[model samples]
Target: MKNTPSTQGRAYSRRDFLKLSGLTALSIGGMTVLTACGPSTETKDSGATDAKSDTASSFGEGGKLRVGMEVAYPPYNWQTSEATDDTIPVEGLDGAYADGIDIFVAKKVAAAFGLEAVAVKLAWSGLIEALNAGQIDCIIAGMTPTDERKQSIDFSDPYFIGHYGLLVKKDSPYASATSFADFAGASVLGQKDTLLDTVIDEIDGVNHMTPVDSVPAQLSHVNQGACDAITYNVENRGGLLAANPDLVAIQFDGSYQLFPDEVSCNVGLKKGQDDVLKKVNDAIAAMGADDSTWETIIARQPA
Candidate 1:
């Protein structure tokens, strides 16, 4: 992967995906269950004392930028058994590597701090706790900096900004929807504990199904006719539509639009890491105009 210079261009819309052969998940409470990334088979909580206190910041040992992610969300991040110049090794999963836009941004941020990038695989719910406990230095997963999250950690400027949409099977009635109003009475599904889930309320008369833990799970439910559609980032349409030829995205850019016009994907850091935050922000600022680049990244997702 190459380092794209930050120009004054806009970032792409949001991202999330994947299905692990041996999937794992953990239950969390409140706003935590709804964050952007999904659960992991791995536990990152080590019960360590708080690494952050007194407004001070510290980096990991050996000049490593220990960034944490679910390592199961594709287009954003996902695990692979094979290594590529585009991947970073998963800290605990031997022979496994993580690849996606998040990994790309993590490397640039690490470079800005003169450190090597290392991927720490963690449950989506455990990222913040892990960061605060010194288990990891920062989180580069595809997380939105929701007001609820700001209470626990500070975030850098957005690395990716995306729009939300719905995915339905090609033969489904919702596939013909051109406006939000067209989906009345249709059942919809979204990832648990994510904006994807909450957005279901935006549709009038729509049957909002219980939230699932991952995009892949949402996909499964849709395929099985358990739901009419699944919420997703419109920017991911290319890869997903290509991979699941049976699906179509209901992306609106005109009259009927995504409830949230733009979803931001930002970096989460433990509070008080002002210096590190600034450095990471600077790296993000240098990553100017990712509109097309991100599409390229999406185009390359493993099928």
Candidate 2:
């Protein structure tokens, strides 16, 4: 049976029920009890219906691929209602929906595999945990493949490469400083537990401010003169710069020792799901070698 719009949105399936029954049997013997109490004609009909439902609910049968992401991040993921017939509402974001680089790219990747794209909103830090828990099949959030994360999950080929930058107030002296060393005596802030925060700590004489809860908060501290600047990726900083006129991005050319040139961000999957990982990676590679996929996703955002 073809998946209609209504059926596509719901998460019910006969296969899922069967899997549930099997698991229930192992834990509670519920299936055995139901079978013993269901020898009637009605039971047989119900069983057949359930079996057909399970077969229809299989992932590949409906041509759907489940993807998880943090819709709060812009340029990568965000909500919109403009609906050019190109975007769809996320599974559980209420009136909000996700679009942008990640969603667009995810749609393309899903299409390449003959799968329908379904977006599942997830917290940034919880993405990996959700993947391992089977809550999500893959994470298309704009996540960097850090060494720490590599130990738990496998990442796809780098689809986008971004550089780090400093966001500061328009009038701050450090606004014009291009190199990390130039902030030797200035106060800096960044999102807590992120690469930006760690990198800022390496600057000599730099009074690093307490880590902020979010990127916007880090930008707010700089705007309020709480810190000289906030270190973050150019993509995120770009959004802040566009939203706050008083903020300026200080691009460090070759001055601030390059952190790493090939910081490739890609989809993440649960470890040992090599088959699914290979399919996703191959889809990314076949879409074209150009980074326009990233640009296209980013272009859908406000800035």
Candidate 3:
């Protein structure tokens, strides 16, 4: 399969499909559940985590720019034990390196800021918490900037635009499904702290299972029949389908419009940091304009 960037721009609002009211209700009702199982609570200062407030200091004191990511999402961010020209050593993990589109974006952002790029491996759920705790400088994970997330951390202009899709077992009833409404009552799973999980409610009567900690867990649930399907994006298609041939990605018809914000992945930083944010945005814009380099990076991803 030839990998190429999507020509579609983010045209829908994240708030339009997944209403903020519903999200707020979910957050409030699921507060206890999230606190117990969501991201770590370790923070640097209780009062310093506001996403709307901007701090004036630049990232890292000198030339060191520490960028954090789950290092688990594929073709976008993933682990590589061996050293390669494209690999960046995981800051604190011995013998492991980070590679993928996120690393590419981080390197460019670092260069724009005149800093050395350092990849900080983190758990998906702990990314925001670590940033708040000052453990890492910025989050370059394939994270979408939802309205809810914007309250706690500011985000740069999208660096990578993704398209949504569902992964289901080839033998499952949903394999032939054509739309979101076709999966009513079918169990589905998504990763925690992601719009993927929240979008499950859009299916109306889907038996939305409890969110998991990682993509591997979601894959296990579906492959084992614990769930009928899982939510993912276009960039994930090659790696995911290759890893499990028994599963296939469902490309819904054109009638289905996705929440644009869900497809827009950006660099996340603590509130303020206008200078750093501008630099990051500029880097992303520059990268986006250069289709050749972007295509080459995508083509070189591990299958």
Candidate 4:
């Protein structure tokens, strides 16, 4: 299989693609429960030492921290064959698969705790279930620590901060819209089960659009006049705009709103995995002290 960039402009090696598709098939063939209910606790610290010890013991022999992520997300995780000095292969992904900033950070955490870092690619909606079932030790998929997610699992301190933005056609009237409320009557959509979908509801009288199956598909919808715009993280929006010159990214200006500072993206662990959570949190804190580390990681990928 050849390593090629995805239609979305992210590199995806053929090996990585086959591996991901195979895993999905295996999961379905076994009738594996792909989705499950998650907790809603907003402020539980489960990444303590005891939890880590327990998780380590559960995984047996080698102290490997199995991490689940969506390898398709660039600047965080993506597929690439031309291994650069910084590219690291995802554990289960094949054909020179590697990840971005988040994977780099996960590597630091794994090293700090003397554990092998293993990456597992899973759908965003199924991440929590995978963690709870021990399919993966933790989730490092750039998932935001939200109040709704806290009930199902615990999260480490935020490692990277980002906010949402709207992606629209360059010449679209909505291109100049700033706030979430600005799209009052415009049709908007986002990835299913993501904050983007739920966040749109905050806008009064907005014509909420149905969620799409993937980021590329959502963008396609906007391109085909199926939707006015799609909302997503600024980092991803940058990648999208870079890949597709016709799309315009609408920055929130001062209108961008996140769930306060407390709710940020972090590594997620199962409810009882306190020890593992603490190890990850401490590693993140250490990483935070070095601004250059993040700068270098960000500079390696497209946009």
TM-score on alpha carbons, each prediction: 0.79, 0.72, 0.76, 0.73
lDDT of 3 by residue, 121-178 (tens): 6667667876776667899988877777788898887766665567899999888888
* lDDT of each residue in 1-303, candidate 2, tens digit only: 111111211122323322222212212111110111111101111112222322333333456666776565556666564455556567644555567667766887788778877776655666776666565667887776677788989877756555455667888887777666778889988776456677675567889788875566776687788888777665444345556779776755632223433234688887887787778777776655343344344444543
Q: How well does candidate 3 match the true structure in TM-score terms? A: 0.76
Question: Which has the greatest TM-score?
Answer: 1
- Counting clashing residue pairs in each candidate, in order, gives 11, 5, 3, 15
| Model 1 lDDT tens row, 1-303 | 111223233243233211110011211111111112322334344333244554324685678888888777767887666678777888866777777889889888888988888898776766878777777889999888777788999988878765567888989977778788989989999887678887788788989998987777787788788999888865555556655668776655431225654566788998997888888888887865444555455555665
After superposition, candidate 2 runs with Cα above 4 Å error: 1-63, 236-238, 253-261, 289-296
lDDT of 4 at 265: 58
Q: How accurate is candidate 4 locally (lDDT)?
A: 0.59
All models, RMSD in angstroms: 9.2, 18.6, 10.5, 13.6
Candidate achieving higher TM-score, 3 or 4: 3
In order, the Cα lDDT scores of the candidates are: 0.69, 0.58, 0.66, 0.59
Sort order, lDDT high to low: 1, 3, 4, 2
Q: After superposition, how far is residue 295 of candidate 3 from its true place, in Å?
A: 3.9
